[model samples]
Target: MTEEPVPVTRAVDFGTAKLLPDVDRARAWLLTVDDAPQSYVDLDDPEHLEFEYTRRIAHVLESAFDTPVHAVHLGGGALTLPRRLALTRPGSRQWVVEADRGLAALVAEHLPLSDPDITVHTTDARAWLAAAPDASADVIVADVFHGSRVPAHLTSVEFLREAVRVLRPGGVYVANIADGAPFAFLGSQLGTVRAGFGQSADLCLLAEPGVLRGRRFGNAVLAAARRPLPLDALARSCAGDAFPARVVTGTALAALTRAPVHDATATASPVPPDGAFTVG
Candidate 1:
């Protein structure tokens, strides 16, 4: 009989990091920091994305980009998406910037990525992006968080501008945001992305119906690009997920707007209530 994997815990720079094994899937693990679920990875099945938001992000990439891509990921939690990208898009070059050095090291030692194409940097996401050459990436994925909240610095128009500079023309920028109905932060972020990219960029949001309707605190995946997004394909992909989600754009997106956030006004995303996203 196969041995059951045990949980491993370590004190990282940001918080206590834990790796909890999936009882049903021997090679699968869920990475959590301070009780908030971070990333779920099935080492034996890179195509399997356990988180709804992760699937939504993957849908955007799968729908929009057919060939290999030069991708930059702001958060590197167990390198889940990087592994998926390596499997789905062979020859793709990926760069992952994770701020928590100790957490990065813990993941590296425990998870042990096999893809040589993916390079992990132990540094702040914003600083790394600011230094990146213009038009250096085909896609940028922003999913960084300190514990449960997205850092204030990463939520501003300035940050989006840096993203725009790094992305090649027509490249996509996708972010995983957490909020509920009356999505002030989410709206502001959308506005910031649009304002940063100007009038030419197209944007959309993918989220569950109830979450969009103010049912609960949850994740929302937002996508933007200089070119038109594959909304039809994205809608279908999101709807077919185990927990169905809807894509909002055009008028729906326009209605959910807020003044663009600047560096001076930015703040970390709102904290969740007790028991929210507590790992079982």
Candidate 2:
């Protein structure tokens, strides 16, 4: 007789989410919150990034350095990217600052980061970033969000400055932002990152062509670095990706950075309208 699979469910502080095993892929799990898919993890294959935005971030990380480097992740959803870093760049030290302690604990209980190099802290990302020492991290990744909306504090110029301050010279800072047509929030964020990193910093935005065109609500990956970004290589990687994405930089990025800068007074990212992310 075949054995029945164990049911997986957890009650996080925000809401109830599930860590369902992928039937077709061994050691793979999908995390969902409020009916929205948040993260996917394949323990057997850490390099397999199932989300387009996540894939874009991974591409930036791969293009940033040839070997493992210290990284700080400002969100810990399923600890997906950190696990990927641990596997892809063995011995890389990583720290994750997640606001939802319950969610963090639940994820750890089910999908533990067996690697000793990755540590998860239950704290606000902004606070952690502010407390971090200068020039301490080689890479800083900001993927923090409450459900689908990123807190305003995390997007403000004040927050971006802390992120920039924590990075080593030539270190890269990457963030995942979601916005709809008009892209006011994304534009402002791009502007904020550029402003924080200064004139010499290289900035790049990556996302599906549709998202870039402001046709619908979607996630965009924004990367900024003190040194020149590897746009050529990143463009090639995105071009060949399963979910073909594009990179916007140079004059094109300048055009998009027209939005006003967001400061501490900014509100949380505008929430998507009902049905914007709903699947039929």
Each model's lDDT: 0.93, 0.85
Stretches of model 2 off by over 4 angstroms after superposition: 1-7, 260-262, 275-280
Candidate 2, residues 198-260, lDDT tens digits: the string is 878889999999988878788999999988899988999999998899899889889888544
Clashes of each: 0, 0
In the range 85-172, model 1's lDDT, one tens digit per residue, is 8988889999999999999999998888878899999999999999999999999999999999999999999999999999998899
Error of 1 at 46 (Å): 1.1
TM-score of model 1 vs. true structure: 0.98
Model 1 C-alpha RMSD to native = 0.9
| Candidate 2 least-lDDT 10 residues | 258-267
Worst 10-residue stretch by lDDT in candidate 1?
271-280
User: Which one wins on TM-score?
Assistant: 1
Model 1, residue 261: C-alpha shift (Å) = 0.7
| Backbone clash tally (model 2) | 0
